[model samples]
Target: MTDVAPARPGPAPRVVLVPGFWLGAWAWDDVAPHLAAAGLDPVALTLPGLEPDHPDRGSVTLEDQVCAIEDALTGGADGVATVLVAHSGAAAAATVALDRHVDEVAHVVWVDTAPASDGFVMNPDVEGPEYPLAVQWDEEMAQGSMRGLTDEQLAAFRQRAVPQPAASLRDRVALTSPRRLDVPSTIVCTAFPAAEYRSYAEQGVPFLAGLLEYRALELVDLPTGHWPMWSEPERLAAVIADRVPRGAR
Candidate 1:
């Protein structure tokens, strides 16, 4: 006589990759295959106005971005959790979405960004529908690190970058549930160190303030530029895969 275990149900946890301002799902091309190779399903999303030459760019709001993520979480098979990987500015919308659909998400990975709390507006400085990529790039260079990118990579980034929707930046983040804090989360520190991230959270930095109250949070230091997918795809993929539960992987 032999005893066998019953088969597990549903699909493995899906990895949903959301890019930040001025970018599209194409931005994740370098990282997706690596995640797939690690036995994980990776889905990169291009939010409403991020598509090149998108006709309705003028009207896309932050709420729309949140909805896009909600749709992704719901579109999957039942009982299959999702690993929502949000990068840079996309963290705002991802924060709200995670709060709304906590049970549907297995884990959240904030790469080079932090979870914004309720009423957090991305950028109030911009007054129009589109924030030019070049202008944004200049600001990023002045205020942030671009350490790991090569000249060719920078060229490709400039060539493909699209205008970010100012409305998305202007609309405030709306959070209703506190349960999201209980969802397992990881902060992948690339442009900065984990210690700095902790300090920022402790100091009540608006974008990272809620982290202080998270029930299951882990900080990991990758030590690269902000856009690790472009600079260190394989390494970033490995870090993300390591977060997934072993059964799902």
Candidate 2:
């Protein structure tokens, strides 16, 4: 008789999730269900400015976004262990918040998102080929894309995709890496190449702290569109589950 091998164990660990640019906390709505089943609790929230109907959306800045997440982490009396997940532009904001509040964060997941970047500094050419929704003025309230939106979704985006603060993206980013964050980080870009307006090609290694930070990064590539949360939530959740271990609290 042949000897049988032992079975592999499942992963564990809860995470705090953040969304990319032009996306509110709603971005992860589809993915949360899968995470819930896998025994990973996802702590999700919208950044301060991306609300559907905020009166003052343009005034939102990087500091403001970071503050909102920091408040959520520190607000509760019982501290929870969270692996921070950031998509797209939110990566910059998350970078700042995590550096300041690492005591509360366990790991960081970058999903087709920019790495820890400088949100405060920018080149003088500044105004790029792209603008918020292709519109220069913040008051217009448009930037970033909604990958799997329907007609109704597009309308909703048109209504809610508020103008990002000019300073947030234009300003130089301020993020520092503490040694404690060395082991828990993963960068998940989609399996396919980025489309004209859908890819995160703008993000490069320069964005990460190759020198100062001591984290080992795992890159998980999956076959899906830009919006994996909507197009392939189950698979995305599986990929995420692989990176985070359970009972990390």
Q: Which candidate number would show the highest lDDT if scored against the true structure?
A: 1
Q: Candidate 1 on 118-201: residue-level lDDT in tens?
A: 788877788877987763356566345676788798888888999998998888888999999989999999888999999988
Give the range of the ten consecutive residues with the poorest summed lDDT in model 2.
135-144
Model 2 per-residue lDDT tens digits across residues 1-249: 112233233433456678766677777887887777666677677887677676765566678888887876565434445667777667777777777876776667778754554443433243532235442324222122334435565565456565555556765667665554564677776634324212333343354442134446665665454567766677777777656544442
Candidate 1 minimal-lDDT segment of 10 residues: 1-10
Q: After superposition, how far is residue 164 of candidate 2 from its true place, in Å?
A: 2.3
C-alpha displacement of 22 in model 2, angstroms? 1.1
RMSD (Cα, Å) for all candidates, in order, is 4.7, 7.4
Question: What are the models' TM-scores?
Answer: 0.91, 0.71
**TM accuracy, model 2:** 0.71
Candidate 2 lDDT (Cα, 0 to 1): 0.61
Indicate the TM-score of model 1.
0.91
Off by over 4 Å in 2: 1-14, 75-79, 118-131, 134-160, 180-183, 191-214
